[model samples]
Every structure is written in structure tokens, then in C-alpha cells.
Target: MSTTQSDRLRELLEPLVAAKDLDLEEIEVSRAGRRRMLRIVVDSEEGVELDACAEVSRAISEKLDESDAMGDEEYVLEVSSPGADRPLTEHRHYVRAVGRLVKLTLTDDAELIARILVVDEAGLDLEVPGVKGRKPTARRVEFADIAKARIEVEFNRKDQNEEDVTDEKEEEA
Candidate 1:
């Protein structure tokens, strides 16, 4: 899409998403065969749920139908939250990832995998896991030194199962 078109789309979408209490993370316009594909990525600190995405999609569709923003083109609109492994490119993204595992690459080309203990304007306090029965260590990384970062998906985190057990016990009380 041209710059003007992209800007116009953002202008049209920002308010709608904001009204729904979601941050518009990304907007991608692409060609899917002959039709255009409009992908909207929205997120929130509490996370975006499936129903929220559906609601946002419906609202976006209604607004577009009432406006000439899409220019009557045949386009598929998809609304979704960022994936589990999506790159952390913004401060807010890092803030949301606190207490989650992540893989970080430093500007000096060093790689580390750690759990985010805290996030501040300066950087992150990461809890680096230990190797071979050693204790986990804490490390501080400044934002300027982070070359790239991505959340590490943990399907079976030990703490997760423990939390579930605790929740079950609480419910039984």
C-alpha cells in the first residue's frame, strides 16, 4: 500500500482499536491471490482474548462498511493478537512479558535465555536459568544493549502445573 493509503488506514483504525482498549500493534496489507488481505494485530497488557478479537473484527468491519476507507475492494479482514513467539520490539511488549521466559540477543552478539523478573524504562532484570543443578542467576540488561528479543514459548513450565494445583485446592476450600 502507498504511504498515504497506509496512513489513512491507520488513522481510521487507531481510534476504533483504542475505543476497545486495545493497542494496535500492527497492520499488514498484502495480496492473497487476487484479493487483498488486511491483517490487524491488537494487544493489551492483560492479553487479548478470542472474543475480543471477534468484537474488534466486527467493529472494524462495520466501520469500514460505513466508510470509503477500503475503497470497495474485495479484502479479507483478520484480527488477532501477537503470537507467543512474536519479537519484542517495544517497551510495552517487554513490560507485558515480565514473569515470562524469553531469548535475548545482545548488541555484542551474546545470546541468553532468561525469565523476565522486572521491566523498567532502562532495561530488564532477567533471571537466567542455571545449568547442571546450578542456581539461577540474576542479570540486568539495558535496552540499548538488546539487539533482539523473543518470548520463549513454554508449554510445560513447572510453575504452571503447580499454580493449577494451587488454584484447584483454593476452589475446593
Candidate 2:
């Protein structure tokens, strides 16, 4: 996949996505069997809903159809939100994942599991989980030092589960 084509696609699609009040997270073109596959990932602070994805898909598909961007090749257009486990490469990804636990791999190959407390252009403020009954410590990690970062799924989150149960009970009452 050529970076030029991807950059062109980003240039073309970014405004369309921004007009709809969403961020164009990523655009990738890959060979799928005989045809090509264009995957567009869109996201928003409020989160991307199914309708939002469909709307972006429709708009992007129409734009692609009108333009000769795909070079007369039949391609599949798939627009979607970034998955929960998607790498936090962009600043907005970190902002969106605030309050969520994340596993970050540093450039030095050090791994840290921390809850995102803040995100700025330069770096992130994370609450590193304490061990042995100690309190969590606040740590700052610059984006340049982060090699990889992904949200960690907390399966047995008692606080969140209790809140959900309470909301359900209230709704039932």
C-alpha cells in the first residue's frame, strides 16, 4: 500500500468527516482477493454509532464513486469506528480513552499499566496502579516514548458493574 494514496485519501475524506463532526481516524487500502478493500475508520468524542458509520460509509462511497480515486477497480468500502483494542497512536485516541485502563509499551521496551488521567499534545498523564496496598502514582509519558498503547478490558470491574445494575434497577422501578 502506497503512503501517497493513503495520504490522498486522507486529504479527500478528512473534510467530509469533519463536516459531519467526526474525526477520520484512519484510511487503508489493501488487496482483498481480486478486488481492493478500502477501510475507513471514523470516530468522535461521543463515540461513533452505527448510524454515524453508515452515514460516513455512504458519503465516502459516493465520493469514491464520483472520483477516479480507485482507478476503475472494483473495491469494497468498509467504514467503522476504531475497535476497543485499537492502538492509541493519535492524541485524540488517548483523550477518548481517558479513565480507561491501558497497557503502554515504552520505546525502551518497558510496559506500564495505567489509567489515563490526562492527554495533551505532548504526552499523557497516567495513574500507575499501585501494588501491595500502596497508592497509585501519577506518571507522565511523552508520546514519542510510547511504542504501543492499547486499552485494557476490565472484566470484573465491580464499581462499573454495580453502577450498571443500579441503573437497570432504577429503570425497572
Candidate 3:
């Protein structure tokens, strides 16, 4: 609820999370009817697994149980990875979104939908989709110029596996 409480929780849990090679993305404390909900979002470049969440949950639960940081309030601890729609706020977020389609909103309020091609310390290289059989064009956006960015869900995403299979079929032919 308060910044102090959130900071305390971060102080208590960051090391435990980092020990498992995960980044503590967020700490949210909210009221759910009678009890408090402590939602902790953790992630790694390789992705978070169910087992990893369970492990982190167990560790954090034990630490909270031992410490009086929760102040006797009943709280539900939820450990999870940032979902597909999570905003791309960090450089690593952009790095992870490479090869995925994203909706980018500039600080000036301009918007563009492009596929990520590269990620560097300063900016990103994107392939802007073309219309009417036109070739896609490359564009670079400095990170400082972005207001918000999120991955666009693609149900039929063409990953490298499918392309490899197609190439194998062609070779067989």
C-alpha cells in the first residue's frame, strides 16, 4: 500500500529472487475483500517456469513468515512472470521482444506497429510492416523517444521451427 512497505518487501525479497537467477520485476500489495494480496512478478531471460514460481513462492513465504514485514495482515502471495501484454519498460524487455511484433507509442504520441529486428543499448531496429505488397522498411527508434511499447499477440506466429521444417521439405524435394 505504502511506498515504505513496498520498499521493505523489495529489500527483503530481491536477494532471494536474484539467488535463483531471476529478476524481481514488481511488488504489488492490494486489498482483496478481507485479506491483502502480495503479488510478486519475477522473470528471467529464458522465461519463468511453474516450478520456478513455486520455488520462489515457497522461499518468499518462508521469509515473510519469519519476518514481521507483513505486520500480521493475512496476505496471499502470488509469484508470476510478466504476461505477454506487459509493457516493455526496460532494455532487457526490448531485447526479449526481439523477433516479435510490437505496438510502439512514441513520447510525442505517434504510434507504429513493427516487428523487432535488433536491440541495442541506445535504441531498437524495427521492420515496419508494408501494405499492398510493398516491402517492409527498417526504422530505428531511440529508447528515450518511446512512451510505451507492448508485444502484440500472434496466435499463428511463424517461428524458426516452422521455417526449418519448410526448408527441410524443400531439400527433400
User: What TM-scores do the predictions have?
Assistant: 0.89, 0.85, 0.94
Candidates, ranked, TM-score: 3, 1, 2
Q: 1-173, model 1: which lDDT tens digit per residue?
A: 45676688889989999999999999888899989999999999899999999999999999989889878779999999999998999999999998899999999999999999999999999999999999999999999999999999998787867999999999999
| Model 3 alpha-carbon drift over 4 Å, by segment | 1-3
User: Candidate 3 lDDT, tens digit per residue, 13-34?
Assistant: 9999999999999999999999
Error of 3 at 109 (Å): 0.5
True lDDT of residue 73, candidate 1: 78
Clashing pairs in 1: none
Selected candidate, larger TM-score, 2 vs 3 = 3
The alpha-carbon root-mean-square deviation between model 2 and the true structure, to one decimal in Å, is 3.4
- Highest-TM-score candidate: 3
True-vs-predicted CA distance for residue 114, candidate 1, Å: 0.6
Candidate 2 C-alpha lDDT tens digits along 118-143:
98889999999999999999999999
Q: Residue 107 error for model 1, in Å?
A: 1.4
Residues forming the 10-long window of minimal summed lDDT in candidate 3 = 1-10
RMSD of 1: 2.8
